[model samples]
Target: MLTLLLLIPIAAEHKPLLLERFRVIDAPDPATRAAAIATRADEIDLVLTNGTVGFKADEIAALPRLRLLAALGVGHENLDLAAARARGVAVCNGAGTNDDCVADHALALLLASVRALPQQGAALRAGIWRDALPLFPHFNRRRLGIIGLGAIGQKIARRAAAFGMVIGYHNRQPRADAGEAVYFDSVARLAAWADDLVVATPGGAATRHIVNAEVLTALGSGGHVVNVARGSCVDTAALAAALRDGRIAGAALDVYESEPRPPAELVGLDNVILTPHVAGWSPQSIEASVMNFVANVEALARGEPLPTPL
Candidate 1:
């Protein structure tokens, strides 16, 4: 039986299925995780981690019997892919498992920000009416720009299109399958052309601060920005400045630089909406993500190609 070390938390309901398949070692707490790896380094064969709580090079080096590393979600940003390659440890992730959930949340944020739903609702609670509150932009007939044209971005585009919004996107390269959507080579150009911007790009050093002050400025004062991607993709300080200075109309974020803690910079601002990094989290998505991990592990055991290798 393969020994599986879990570095990320799994829901209580999902734990039983994993326990039935492998000799599971649950150590989500950082200190306990370190102790587990040190004590059972030789026994561990497969390791399950998320994109944020990645398995580093040092940890990979310590595990002599490790053969496979799997991320519960699409992100593998913090995963030390180089070390995994050197050690011949196959890496896989649950790419499409949560695409629908994430895309749904992205659209929800976009609609809320563009229409100032939260602010309006708050006003009503404070004994204010629509006449006292500032009028917000309509969601329909606006230009929507997406930073990434990946699986999730494409889904967001389709949803936006249903609302009568014109779609545009920026990617490292134009995708042939993008369908009717206009493509911009640079992020700045995309922002300039768009009335609203949605960021769905991957996170890492390369993409860190891809959406900065300049991009925010290009988005213009009438525009709103929504981020369902990694927080590192947008500069938090810059976003706060933009919202404060009216560089952009408003903003909404599902992910921010501060993971567990709230983003201190934008929390005071009323124009911006924030949700803890839960855009991709839902019962359906969680189940699919766990099942995807199980499939990858089973494929690894049978020497079959992984469904979603990173």
Candidate 2:
């Protein structure tokens, strides 16, 4: 039987299913975890982890029997892809498993930021009858620009369409199904053209800091930005500076450059909306992600290619 190291804790509903076929082990300490992995190198054939909890290259080299490395979530930004490819190890991710949930959360951030919902809610709690007060900024007929036109971007595009927003996008290659939206060959050009920007590209070196000061400035004043993609895709320091200096109108983000803990600069910003890095997490999305991983594992065991191979 193949030994699988279940890096993250599995839900109770899925625990029985995992333990039935493979020898599963959980580690309470990081050193103990590394030790367990190293000690069982010869017997372990698969490693299950998320992008944030990827196995290092040295760890991979130690595991002679390791054949497959699976990312439980869509973002594999931290995974060492070059090493995995060099070792002939198959890497797979649960792409599209949580796209709907992420898109929904992106919209939540967009609406909240655009309409200043948080500030409005705060005013209401203080018994301020602000109906006659000036309403917060809105997107209205503004153009929404998306950086990536993949599955997640497509979902965001569909939602944007429902809001009567014009859409534009920039990608490595032009997509034939982008509908009525125009496509830009460069990110800067796209930002220059869009009134609001939502980044939905994959996370990796290729996409790191795609939204920098130049892009932010190009987005121009009275523009809003939303990010449901990897945090590395945006320059947080630049974004914070822009927000402080009014270089841009406002921003909303579900992911930060330094996640789990946001930058100190953003903590006091009234124009920015922040949430923990959980845009892709929902009850339904969790189930779909787990099932996708299980399907990949089962396919691998049967000597078949993964449905969403990285």
Candidate 3:
């Protein structure tokens, strides 16, 4: 039986399914995980990790028998792809498994931020009425700008379209199948044109802080920003400043530079809404991701191409 070391936390309900197939080693804490890897290096043939808790080159080298490295979700930003390539280890991820869940959350954040739903709800619960509270704008018939035009971004665009939102996007290059969504070459231009900007791009060096001060400035005083992608994609300090100064109306985020901990910069701002990095997490999505991982492992065992190789 192949030994699989899990560096990310897995739900207890899902452990049985993995245990039935592989000798699973569960170590989610960084210190515990490192010790476990060191002690059982020789036994580990497959390693499961996520973008945030990435597997390093030295860790890859420590396991001579490591044949496969799998990311639970679409992101493999922290995974050392070069090391895996050099070592001839198969790399795969659950790419399309949680697209719908993430997109749904993105739209939820967009609507909530635009309509100031959370703020209104809080005021009502505190014994305030609509007459005393500030009125927020409608979410429909506004321009929605997406930073990434990938699968999740496309899904968000589709959902936004239903509400009469005019879609626009920025990418390295315009996609051939973009259809009616207008394309912008630069992020600032996209923000300038959009009433609300949504970030759904991948996390990495190339895309780090893609939404910075300049882009936020272009978004104007009435604009709202939503990020369902990596936290590193948006500069937290910049976002906090913009929100505090009323440079931008409001912001919502599911991910931030600070993981497992709240972003200190934006947590105190009433204009911003925050959720732990769980935009892609749901019962349905988790089950699909786990099954996708199983399928990839089976494909490797059969010497067939992986369904979603990175």
lDDT of 2 by residue, 13-112 (tens): 7667678877877753577678887687788888878887777888888888888888888878777778988999889998989999999998888888
State the displacement of the C-alpha of residue 227, model 3, in Å, after optimal TM-score superposition: 0.7
RMSD of each: 1.0, 2.0, 0.8
In model 1, which runs have C-alpha deviations exceeding 4 angstroms?
A: none
Return the TM-score for candidate 2, rounded to 2 decimals: 0.92
TM-score-superior candidate, 1 or 3: 3
* Predicted model with the maximum TM-score: 3
- Give the number of the best model, judged by lDDT: 3
lDDT of each: 0.93, 0.85, 0.94
Q: Residue-wise lDDT of candidate 3 within 141-209, one digit each (tens)? A: 799999999999999999999988999999999999988999999999999999999999999999999
Enumerate residue pairs that collide in model 1. none
Q: What's model 2's overall lDDT?
A: 0.85
Ranking by lDDT: 3, 1, 2
